[model samples]
Target: MSESEAGRITIDTSRPHPARVYDWWLGGKDNYPVDEELARKILAADGTAVRGARANRRFMHRAVRTAAEAGIRQFLDIGTGIPTEPNLHQVAQGAAPESRVVYADNDPIVLRHAEALLKGSAEGSTDYVHADVRDPDTILRLAGESLDFGRPVALSLVALTHYLGDEDDVYGLIERYVARLAPGSHLILSQVTQDLSPEGVARAAELFRRSGTPFYPRTLTEFARFFDGLELLGPGVIPVYGWRPDPEDVAAQAEGVVPVYAGVARKP
Candidate 1:
């Protein structure tokens, strides 16, 4: 239930998985009934659970565009859930066709769909690693096969960090990966926060805890620490939909009460 075997993948439908449940929220068919069951429970607790999930994915799109437009050609994405359209590669390679991407996830389902993620541009490279975020050494080692650590890279951890509680040393773990990057390297992170829907988020967290899943939403201060030593990008640490939002939606969704906070930071 914690981690899947490397070569042998067996999905357990008895309990809910964070990735699968998230897939359900994203309207993907990669999830099971168990995932939907838990997802419903969460949705019942938080009315905007589905909305927040979609918003989070949009954040990924915008963030990747920002990175690509900034000339960051290498991308390392951890906790990559089911392969939805406009994936990291599609967006990054769309902007810069030569962009290389490495996707990592411990979920067996993600590995099963690795083929879809591997389809990168001929001018670029795409690879998937069956690993967990906690194992940064392995992730970085395998991802290095395609990406050049000597150059600027964008390390993206989208809608994923809240799974690691304080005891997991979220700050130290992230520091390990950022430490390996050269200057100008970027960190793209978006995580859920209780700032907007405190009560709803708390109830949802309790539900996840009872389901044997660890969900930890942090305060703005704690979340900002994850980007220490890096210069935060514009609209720093605001709601996921609020960061450099599209002109049309900026005023409308700007004040939208979403539960996630996103930010991009440069290593320099």
Candidate 2:
């Protein structure tokens, strides 16, 4: 595949970005000072912030593995933050060597790091798209080049959408993307929830706004609303950390919900 127009990407280091801040939270070196400052503030309120990022990554790993095992070989992962080791393609391709995966993100840092995320097994294909989640058409057009729309594809919007807030027509965006896929296509989503700690969530939301990134946490019910017309998977909508977890780590996640819930559903 041709290289994306990385020159078109603009990095505004004056303010913290969601991708870089999240990268810092995950303990990656791609983040900047502004990102670290905001991440530290969030961690001050929630000591498990780093653990939460790890859990979210683990959930992505499990979801991709489940999709690959279920024979879903094509993936369209939007809002794919900075490249981390064993990315979605790595997990899916490990389970199904021929899996075709497309990763998309708006951040220039993520685009610069796309080369690392593109590494895949010899039998699989991995590509990157520089686009925003708000523009569904661009993502669809770009992702379509790498994935087959006539077959089952997994659309992963992990740890995203929350950034869009309620006024962003989040559900409509999901429908726009999911409408292009064939039946049995999967919708894998993970979002922050404020049901357990509304006050802490509100504080975090304020921090994001002050950092120049508009983010709002959703309730469990609001988070589940995104799956209205789809068939939720077996485990159903649950905290990302607890969804089909191994017996050993389940209890540890129980102590702290991490204010995030995730689920996978299938289009009829």
Candidate 3:
């Protein structure tokens, strides 16, 4: 995959990284022992950790497909964890072969596996940016090389914001990113919430905090605020599995409720 100059890539196995922990939850082997340790701890605290990770992946697939079917060819996905199969670009290009996609993440391991993410349809283009979500300027500037902000681009940050604390200005950060999108662009988001399983979510957050990664599980009202000036689609801001579920998602719902809220909104 083509990448912007992000300086020397480094992987610190000394501590657990959110991306590595997420990869471990998704059953990927790219994570270190530290990541698996935290993943197991969180799973032990919350039985739905594995299910929640899978649900978020499915939600991303559906959301990207929805945007692609609606004629949004350009995509910018920040906080991309790892090179999972049927990733954002795969889903987008599956709907429209000419789709252009840019993936941004701070994880060095993701960059190491980025070559796998670049195997897209010949009709489309895929690029990766080794950057963090907190640095919107770098992400936007690098992604702009592959995507046109003048057109309707699909911006996705699925299951990512919960990792950012209030000091990160999460809401303001989202606004800054959204402000760059053109009219008809789509903003896709999914976040961890305590509204569904309060106790379990609380325990999980505590575990994350203890590991030096601050977690913020928002309530429904707080989560809804992220879509402030956009037009929410049908079944707006509901549980991850309930947002236009396919047969697979329908069966997943029977597994039990996952404490995550997801929504897709159009920039008017």
Higher-lDDT candidate of 1 and 2: 1
| Model 3, runs deviating above 4 Å | 1-7
Question: After superposing candidate 2, which stretches have Cα over 4 Å from the reference?
Answer: 1-4
lDDT of 1 by residue, 18-72 (tens): 9999999988999999899999999999977887888888888999999998889
What tens digits encode model 3's per-residue C-alpha lDDT throughout 1-268? 3445333566789999999999999889999989999999999999999999999999999999899988999999998988889888899999999999999888889888888888888999999888889999999999998899999999999999999878999999999999999999999999999999999999999999999998999999999999999999988999999999999999999999899999999999
Which window of 10 residues has the lowest lDDT sum in candidate 3? Answer: 1-10
lDDT of 2 by residue, 1-268 (tens): 2454776667888888888888998889998898899999988876666766778888898888888888899999999999888789989998988999999998989988888988899999999988889998988888888888999999999989789876778888888888898998999999887876677778888888887788878888888898989999978999777788865457667567577888999999
What does the lDDT read for residue 90 in candidate 3? 90
Sorting all predicted structures by lDDT, with the top scorer first, yields: 3, 1, 2
List lDDT for all candidates, in order: 0.89, 0.86, 0.92
Instruction: Give the higher-TM-score candidate: 1 or 3.
Output: 3
* Per-model RMSD to reference: 2.8, 1.6, 1.5
- Model 1 spans with C-alpha error above 4 angstroms: 1-7, 247-256
